[model samples]
Target: MIDTADEFESACRILAAASGPVAVDVERASGFRYSARAYLVQVSRRDAGVFLFDPPAIGDMQALQRAIGDEEWVFHAASQDLPSLRELDLVPPRIFDTELSARLLGWPKVGLGAVVERTLGIVLKKEHSAADWSTRPMPQSWLEYAALDVEHLLDVRDLIADELAETGKLEWALEEFADELVRLPKPAPAEPWRKLNGLNKIRGRRNLAIARAFWLSRDALARELDAAPGRLVPDRSLVAAVVAQPRSKGELSSLKEFTGRQSRTQIDRWWQAFVDGRATEDLPAERVPSDALPPVRAWSGRRPEADERIKAAKPAVEAHAEFLSIPTENLLTPDHLRRVAWQPPEPLTEDAIGEALASHGARPWQIAQTAPIIRSAFVHAAQASDDTDESAS
Candidate 1:
């Protein structure tokens, strides 16, 4: 591991002189840690070999960033690693996401191992993928596993690039990568605790408040200790406690359903949170208003015309994606299709549909191909609705 300042700088210097795009991957303790931090960062470059760095042991990453910052970085699933990499100021100027490339190419399997096996004919041992990455002095086998992540990534990127170029979709991949590079972080939901497991089993605003309180208390404790909330107290246990409505710490501990590594030890804390939730008047509503669209199944009865629009347009867009030899979601997101179907703009010309598609985060290549299909399908949907109404009358 490149822990000392001199060893780190030496690795950076080697990477600086290495030719071609830098292949990079980050190992994070996703389920085991509260914070999504880069426990270990792996980078491989041609001629320079691969370097493994202990992110926590390193003081700053600016030196390493300068070494290869301007070069295009390659990753199998870039988005999953980019956030943690950014936390260390190791930003990339451009990226080549092999997973996204495979998706655009309409490959059946896009996982790193699958892509590697399919593209390079090498199978990667993935037993250590879910291992705790934050362990100090990581096991030798684990280090090798981390190193393997980026070992053949650049080769996969090259092979995929050639195939994409041959298919006339290289530009599409670049545009997709650019958009992903600048994608903004999603805003945190207002009522995150509302998504608790078995939440529907608990009814009434008071009970909901208790659930929310328990979730919030658990979240605070988890964050403070840097432990995954689920590790400390599983969602099922938290929800069960609310349903049981334990009045005291002893009662809470006595319930078998209310159990976890920390549940019994932190009984007083949980009890207090429950008491506060019971006394507080700030109860959550049963249903919240949102801009989210109704399910497509419900649209058939609630909005017949809109239902026809999605039914006709969705399959049409999907068929076009097939014609282009690309995945439907890769061509355009389903949410965007649903949004346009639910509420199309005035003067729904091809240009208007294209604009709508762009507004919903569709790339130019996607809008160019799908806008006409959507406009024509919408026109047919309206005409079909009119015909049905006339026959009924």
Candidate 2:
């Protein structure tokens, strides 16, 4: 492991002299740690063999960045690793995502191990994939597993790229990878506590407020202790506490879910959470305001005409996707379909529908195939509306 700045510079010198695209992978402590920082980063090249760096110990990587500035980085899932890599100022100018390429080629199983096994006839062992990388004195077997991740990435990329070229989908794959590079991280949810697994089972706004308060306290404690929020207190216990609404420390201590050693030690802390929750002035809203269109399945009861429009538009999209041999979602997203059907653009001509699709992030190919179908559906709905008005008169 290249831990110190001096060791990192030596590794950078070696990598800078190598001649080929870089294969990159990272190991993170997802459930075991509070942060999403990369614990270990592995990079391999045709000439460089393989190199591993401990990111936490090597504080600055400007030299390493300079070495890889102009090379194309290959990753099994580029988007998943890019964010953590970016945290260390390691951004690639060009990238190829094998996972995205496999999806474009319509491969059913696109996992790293699956793709390598099928394409290169190499079956990778995945035993330590979920092990805690935050532990010191890293095991030799785990390090070997990490190294193997990037060993055949270059060969995998070549074989997949060749297949994409033969099938005339190379441009499509490039477009998808470019989009992933520029894609922004999703914003944190407004009420993260409400997303707990069993929160929906809790009744009443009052109980929800109590559960939310408990979740917030647990989250703060987790951060302080550098542990996962779920590890500090499970969602099931939060929901149970809300249901029981225990008024005293004694009552809260008697709950089965709170019988763990940690929970027992933190009995007063848990009791205070309940106390503050019951006394909070602003209880959480039962339902947050939403700007999104309602579910398509609910359109029948909410608006029959909108339902008619969606039913008319779907078959055309399905036919086009089948003809082109692509997934229905890749052809046109359901959210885009629903938005257009709910409130179509004015004039509802082929041109207007085309612009609408573009604003909704549809590619040129998708817009060309889906615009006409959506226009026809809206036009038919308009004619039906006109006839209904005339008959009422």
Candidate 3:
């Protein structure tokens, strides 16, 4: 385990002198910690071999980044690790995501272990996936598991790249990889309390407000303790306490989930949260945001023409995706499809539809393939509307 500045410097020299793209992987203590910091970073190169460095210990990766200058960094699921990597001032200039490539090539299973076994006849162990990587004096066994993650990643990348090239989808994969580089982790959701599981079961705005209070309280406590929000106060227990609306700290502590030592200790805090919730003015309503689209399920009554447009447009997308043997989602996001279909361009022609898709961030390849199909669907729908009107007249 390289921890000191000297060791990291040595590792950098080894990496800088190595040939070919570097393979990278990171282990994060997701369920065990509040922050998404990388506990361990593992890197491999064909000549430099595998090196596991403790990011928290060395506290400097600038030297490491310099070592890896313009070489492509290969990762299994690049998005999952990229954000944590960015925290250490490490960002890949060029990246090749094997998982994204597999999805583009229409692989049925894209998990690292599954893809490795299918492509290279090797099985990866999976026991330590849930282990707390933030523990001090990292165990040797866990270190070995982390090392194995990047050991064969370069080989796997080579094989997958060849297959992508054979099918003339290499450029497509590159485009997706480039897009992934700019893809930041999704923003913290708005009204995060509304996302609590089984919150819908709580009746009335008052009780909903109570649930929100509990959620905010729990989130603050979790952040203070550097613990996962769920670990601090399970969602189910929070919802139960709010729904029951226990009048006092003692009454709230009587619940089974709250009887645990951890929960019992925080009874006053929980009770205060409930009281504050009821006393607060201007509670949030469950209405959609002004700029947001309504749920697709309600579109039939809310916007019947949009519903008709989407229904007409979907088959075209599915047919094209099937012909190309890629996931329909990779071809074009369903949300983007819905957006274009709902408000199709004026004088709907192939060029106009293409412009709409491009505006919504569709790649050129995607627009080139999907625009013609969507235009045909729109034109056909318009003709059907004209025929219906003529018959009524």
Give one digit per residue, the lDDT tens place, for model 3 in 1-393: 899999899999999999999999999999889899999999999989999999999997899999996799999999999999999999999899999999999999999999999899999997899889999898999999999999999999999999999999999999889888996666777888888888888877777788889889888988898888888778888878877778788889888755332577888888889998888885768553655677888888998778778888898899899999999999998878898878889988889988889887788888888999998887787777778889999
lDDT score, candidate 1: 0.92
Model 3, global lDDT = 0.88
TM-score of each: 0.97, 0.91, 0.95
- Candidate 1, residues 1-393, lDDT tens digits: the string is 788899999999999998899999999998999999999999999999999998899879899899998899999889999999999998999999999999999998999999999999999999899999999879999999999999999999999999999999999999999999999888888999988888989999999888899999999999999999999989999889988988677889899988788988998888988998899999999888888888899998999889999999999999999999889989999999999999897899999988998998999999988999999999999998898899999
1 or 2, which is superior by lDDT?
A: 1
Q: What C-alpha lDDT do the candidate models reach, one value each?
A: 0.92, 0.85, 0.88
> Best-fitting candidate, measured by lDDT?
1
Better model by lDDT: candidate 1 vs candidate 3: 1
lDDT (tens digit, per residue) of candidate 2 on 229-283: 7776778887888888787899888888764435777877888889888888888
By TM-score, is 1 or 2 better?
Answer: 1
Off by over 4 Å in 3: 257-261, 288-290
Sort all candidates by lDDT, best to worst: 1, 3, 2
- Minimum summed lDDT over a 10-residue window in model 2 is located at 257-266
Q: Count the backbone clashes (under 3 Å) in each candidate.
A: 0, 0, 0
